[model samples]
Target: MNSLRAILLGTLAAGLSAGGALADGVVNIYTYRQPALIQPVLDAFTKETGINTEVLFLDKGLEERILAEGQNSPADVIMTVDIARLTSAKAKGITQPLNDETVNKNISAEYRDPDGHWFGLTKRARVIYASKDRVKDTSITYADLADPKWKGKICMRSGQHDYNLGLFGSAIAHWGPEKTEEWMKGLKDNLAHKPDGGDRPQAKSIAAGECDIAIGNTYYVGLMRTNEKEPEEKEWGNAINVLFPTFENGLTHVNISGAALAKDAPHKEDAIKLIQFLSSDEAQRIYAEKNFEYPVENGLEPSEMVKSFGELKADTLPLADIASHRKEASEMVDRVGLDDGPST
Candidate 1:
């Protein structure tokens, strides 16, 4: 906590020690990510490269803000969650394509654009968590989450969250708009609680006996397990079991939190350098463990937290499908009226 505070304070003040500021690099980042989450790769880059880094961490609406800033934006790179943010940035022409071979080689074709527009560093899967005592004979797929028996027994984060949007996008890719919307409506009707808090809170609610099931990314469970301040987190960890839906019909839906270069970046080279560095093997390993996520590169073991939760198959569906259908996915959330409180 103290170290994270120092990093935040230092970055906010741009208060580099007397000597570091004179170096050959300063990369400004617009991050729709928490400071704690990205600090590992950021600090490592600075340690090795002597670059001064400045980050503006905002939780929501980074794309609109960047578009509003235009050329005047001081940001060199923008990092965000899910394909929606990355795709929207590319679609709006707010991102610069990275033509570097190192990035192209390291990130997979499914995780990035062939045009080198953006790159994925880490992956998160949206899978099912059922209270061991309550949910029997777990369903085989996300489609099964909408089963009539599961109605009023599920806990999920808000529909507006990017994670849910990406999952919806995957559904659209497979089932088409109309069928996807129908599924969303059914899923909403089955929702046990109003959309509130993040994935962890939904899990915590399940642990607290407010719900019997949760739909969240794998990492949140990892994070909660490591949360030192919340002893209840231990019980939170104990309350549910992970079930990766591999029903032989299709792959599970997953999403990524990734980075892209600014369209009119002021420090273009540094931005590319940072992206390149994050995609490096060392940095990716650090990201995998520190954030409790899966690396985009092959052969790295998933973080221990993910391992503890259980093993699962990732949906091999191309990520672009998530971007293409983000709109309809969101509309179904509103249309289904799944806006009840966290635990009903």
Candidate 2:
């Protein structure tokens, strides 16, 4: 996989050096999101605007690759998951402020960068998945996870994973570092096993009786439930019920899948147009139905599968604020030895 990625990157750099950016009607993309996930929307953009798009997908090193390419990078727009990546791109000087009125109108202020460096395209909540046969309560709070009643009954991914770090960052925002650390320690004490694997495995653990409840993103449930290609994953999805956990503020914690304009975009105009189109009603609907994520655009509804999870009252805390404390949250994770599970 690493070799293939290196070859792709080498080919891309060579192609860019040879031709610079593509012609007037074309825009290039560098995305952390899989191309298949965003291809439908890109196809729609091409159909409507007659502007062609070229994508270079990478799982990691997106910013570094662009930085390495300097002013000659072919990336016109950068698309990625998580607020931390967006903010980190901005901090690294790889992204520039968008400041477009259409993008601003489509996305809520809380979901976009305050300075216009990035805009959220969709939302997914950090939620709890409880075993359908073992757990019954629908309403749960983040604070409740720390109670001794759940000790040896919880499961999660690595503490340093970006998803958990985002949630931890929110904890710091709401409870302050010291209190959040204490809460994290309590939560760690409840681990069913050493924190490992992605969100889906956590749900699988619940189904297999390894744990009663687990932390995961809301959309993973939707994906697992509808995945016809993998029947076992369908079983994992059916084994749990979604619970919207909140802070004392009465708002659920949510994160974003977002995009930014590349700093040295050679196709700036078309890139901006593509981004604006992504926020439009048609594109938003496509994203919602295709990805099972909440649309950033107001009045757009998520897919019916997602609607089954119940209402999400997303916390109004600015993601930028959450991004600010991610470092501290990570430090606290190590300090409490969260990834070591309860044994340590």
Candidate 3:
């Protein structure tokens, strides 16, 4: 990680030394998303629009790197997988506000920033993964996660993880801070073990008989099913059924994979064109299909693998509301020691 950071920092320094022109017809992107997932879309964009793209894939510190580069930063767009990261880019003042009819028309209001700092490209539900044999409940709700009946039968990633924090943030947004804190405590006490690993590992744990139910994103199930390198993961995928849990007053909680325009972009016009194209139905179809995520544009649908999980009724609670409450959610994670699991 440190070596990758140093390399990116050096690249930024070189851009600064070279006056940051980046040539015409080229868009420089700094993304936290893996290149493999988005490379096909970029290739398609270049082929159709004649605008070459140069992507710098970073696992962390995209905002900090851009901050360090100041006005000399050559980044045209910033793409990442969560609402928190996109909001962080906006909060850091490193992203430009974009106002375009194409963007507005393609994206739903809940997924787009009112100030146009960021726009979500795709959506993912924070759904439940239940054991196919051990768990028989077909209907579930997010609030039911706090029920004592499921104690010690739950598996989860760290509560402090961005995905969980986003869910908790939505809880706070809907249920208020006190109720959210109590729910966090109840959910923590029900953990089968100390929270560890990413979403996929939760399914792995269920297959290992460590837990009966796990919380994970919808796409990890797809990734596990398609994981040719690890055929055992197919077993894990097959051992579970997805359940979209909803809140009492709202629909199921969903987060996004989104993008923002760089504040000091060298190729502004090209950047707008690229973001517009990404929001278009053609690009959205390719983008969502690549990862088994639901497309953000209305009238578009998720891939067949995603649809097989059944329909998702996404909560209309604006992403801006949830993003605003993340800090409190993160603090509650530590306050309740959610990652520590139940005290033995």
Candidate that would win on lDDT: 2
C-alpha TM-scores of all predictions: 0.86, 0.94, 0.94
Candidate 2, poorest ten consecutive residues by summed lDDT: 13-22
Each prediction's total of clashing residue pairs, residues at least 3 apart in sequence or on different chains, is 2, 0, 0
Q: Give per-model CA RMSD.
A: 5.5, 3.3, 3.3
For candidate 1, lDDT tens digit of each residue in 1-344? Answer: 45554454454346434333223478877888887888888999999888777777777766766666656566688888778878888888888888898888778788887677788888887888778777776554877777777778888888878788888778777778887777666777777767788888877888877888888888877777777888788678667787776433456777888889989777888888999998888888787788888886646677666788666667777788677777877777777676654233
Better of 2 and 3 by lDDT: 2
Candidate 3 wrong stretches, greater than 4 Å: 1-21
TM-score of 3: 0.94
What TM-score does model 1 achieve against the real structure?
0.86
RMSD of 2: 3.3
lDDT for predicted candidate 3 compared with the true structure: 0.89
lDDT of 3 by residue, 76-167 (tens): 99999889999999999999899999899889899999899999998899999999999999978998898998999999998988999999
Model 3 residue 334 CA deviation (Å) reads 1.3
Pick the winner on lDDT between candidates 1 and 2. 2
lDDT (Cα, tens digit) per residue for candidate 2, span 1-344: 45655565578956443453456788888999988889899999999999988888888898888887777667899999999999999999999998999888888899899999999999899999999999988888999999999999999999999999999999999999989988999999999989999999999999999999999999999999999999999999999999999999899999999999999998999999999999888888887678888887547878889899889888889999999999999999999999999974
